[model samples]
Target: MTLVNNPSRTARAGVPRQARAGRPPRLSGRRLAPYLFILPAVVLFAVFKLYPIGWSFVLSLFKTVGGVDTFVGGENYSRLLQDPLFWTALKNTAIILVVQVPVMLALATGLAVAFDSTLLKGRSVFRLGFFLPMVTGLVAYGIVFSVLLNEEHGLVNWALSLVGVDHVPWLTDPLWAKVSLGIALTWHYTGYNAVILLARLQTIPRELYDAASVDGAGAWGAFRHVTLPGLRPAILLTTVLSTIGTLQIFDEPYVLTRGGPDNATLTIGVYLYQNAFVFFDFGYASAIAYALAVLIGILGLIQFRVLGDKK
Candidate 1:
């Protein structure tokens, strides 16, 4: 018998030499399905989010006059530096950030602790009630608050009068307007923060608390030693989020106070809205927007450094 080796016969009967040699196989439709599935989302994000962001930066470099855009380099940003209204708006936002965030977070932390307590009853009902404010429409809540906080005929003032307390000017005086805005903001967002903190609280090991109890730590001591340490990350997360939201506050101040009482409540976001929509200064508005973004970025970095885990 003659022994014959045929490459063609082997090729027809077995895997290709390249595949057998460990070369990667061509990707089939099944392998490419995920990318195809996400293609529409990628395209939409580019069109809606990425494009606007890029164009807004470009728009900031050009001054819009009489419906025509003229390149002005960094003049808009320079003008922002000189703009007193912008400074005032920044100041107001700082006040809110300083006052509102801590108060809201403190309240949220307390509420979270309360909700996490085994002694508390109707936990689900309370949680849902608290969370309902978060779902309420911004405009609707703002409108409701405007009515409730009105100085002359509002329910709050009426109650104050009945208690023989003077009717506080909730939204009229400059200082009082900021207070009212803070109150509204805290009421609207504290629940949301509480819910987040509660979720974080639930993840903490119950053994730690039991150990602390065995060590004769009281409720306050246990919370100080164990609960707070466990809650650090969640508190930091809430603080950063609250900072961003407070800095960019618009709808609440806009609808409730219209950044009124001599621009006392004018936040950066409201200022940006005014520049873009009210005055039609698209270039300056874009500049303000970017400046606000930079401010947020700086503050976020600072917060992470100050509050993030050391290790």
Candidate 2:
């Protein structure tokens, strides 16, 4: 005799045979294990990040004077619009972004390619030297650059003097101060971008370049058709990261130039700090913070749409 298990019979019984046969039950906690593991991180983010941002908005609605606060609707934002110093800060920051980002990324891409090349010698030592600026203290970096860019005694001006050019005022003149700030930004971030691009470069298979060469493509063609397309994502990443940092730049301008030479290097972040800590105008500072956030968000979206890998 042959025995058959019928689902119809099991349906009539109102429970599957496996359930009736004393199969072990799954604990609810076991099902929730993953959520439990991430709960702490979620709570911390909500408390520290989300709460502070929300509070800043609330603070922006109030008028604060000498450590006292009174309700004042939209006054801080109104004041931000009329502030000339804020406008100056914004203009200086835009100049830095326009000039520094492209130059830094170009140098970074070149360094990445050089490091990845088999013909390059002392590659490890070169990488270490490139990376040394990043891990060092930001204030220390600013101080060293300040001394090295001084008008008369600086090594940079001395080097130029050797070529029959007179000493250039790196921090004393308005135009040169902005230019010097751009140079400092480029030097600080080029290696960081190089490391990121190099990591991306390593992942690209060599077969693509080989195929390009076989197709009679020369060095420039190989880079254009193969390397650039593959590096698109990394370029976008570094660009967006650099944009955010540039928009929020403070320590370098503050330490090196003190936003001086007639406010040539006062960025939004440095100005925001000045409003909050220096002037003690918490309400206006909060409004400035919000404005900076909105600007960053808009620029970030533009970069994504323009440079995204889809087309």
Candidate 3:
């Protein structure tokens, strides 16, 4: 029997050369199905996040005071720069960032290390307890903290009274109000960071610790050399996130102190909300929002510069 290859006959039989060669044809629209599945999320993010940000920037250029809405080229921004209240809010926010973030993250790291350590007992219970606070709603926690720190009757104040210390105004006094807010913020975020750091800690190779031990490196040395480097990425991410959150802090200040005691606890977020709803200066509020955004962006850049990979 003679078998001959014929191009015209093969073409009529409807098979491509690539198929005959045991190779598939070039991928087309079907290959893009995965992207297509995620298209809705991209569209939602553009609509909810990107569009609102762009609109807010445009709104910042307009003055909406009383019932009139008129474009006011950089006037609102100029006023923002000159506003002492803005400066106070900014200073308060800066203080929170500097003091609270490191303390919160350090606590979270300690919790993560203990939870991840073999010597630690009841790890599951402690891990759950660390993470439990995060499961509480922000507003609920804020209100709860307000009561727990009440000057005359709060559990904290009562305990202090039992120790012969006079009642400390946790919310009324300026410094105490800031301290109260810092404590609230730390409680709100530490558990979340601990969970993230614990995940990262678990990823670190146990052999590294063993090798360090063989080299006569103690726990502190192992932590300094092995653990820290492993957790850098997670730490940087949480630091940037904490910075942004502090810069935009509002709820605890608003709910706990109402940015009160002579605006001592005022934050950029609370101030922005005050302008928009209380004062009805939407334009000025927009400017504040944008300014906070810029601050957050700058701080994030600084963190990345300081902590990011060298190469």
The best candidate by lDDT is 1
Task: Provide the clash count, candidate 3.
Answer: 0
Please tell me which model should have the higher lDDT, number 2 or number 3: 3
**Arranged by lDDT, best first:** 1, 3, 2
Deviating ranges (above 4 Å) for candidate 3: 1-36
- 45-67: candidate 2 lDDT, tens digit per residue: 99999999999999999987666
TM-score, ranked from best to worst: 1, 2, 3
By the lDDT metric, which is better: model 1 or model 2? 1
Model 1 weakest 10-residue run by lDDT = 12-21
TM-score of each: 0.92, 0.89, 0.88
Model 2 accuracy (lDDT, Cα)? 0.91
> The CA-based lDDT of model 3 is what?
0.92
Tens-digit lDDT string for candidate 1 (1-311): 99899987777567755677798668789989999999999999999999999999999999977789999999999999899999999999999998888999999999999998889999899899988999999999999999999999899999999989998998999999988998898889999999999999999999999999999999999999998999999999999999999888899999988999889988899999999999999999999999999999999999999999989
Best by TM-score: 1
Give the per-residue Cα lDDT of candidate 3 at 243: 90
lDDT of all the models against the reference? Answer: 0.93, 0.91, 0.92
The clash count for each model shown is: 0, 0, 0
lDDT of 3 by residue, 118-236 (tens): 89989999988878888898889999999999997899999998889999999999999999999999988998999999999999999999999999999999999999999999999
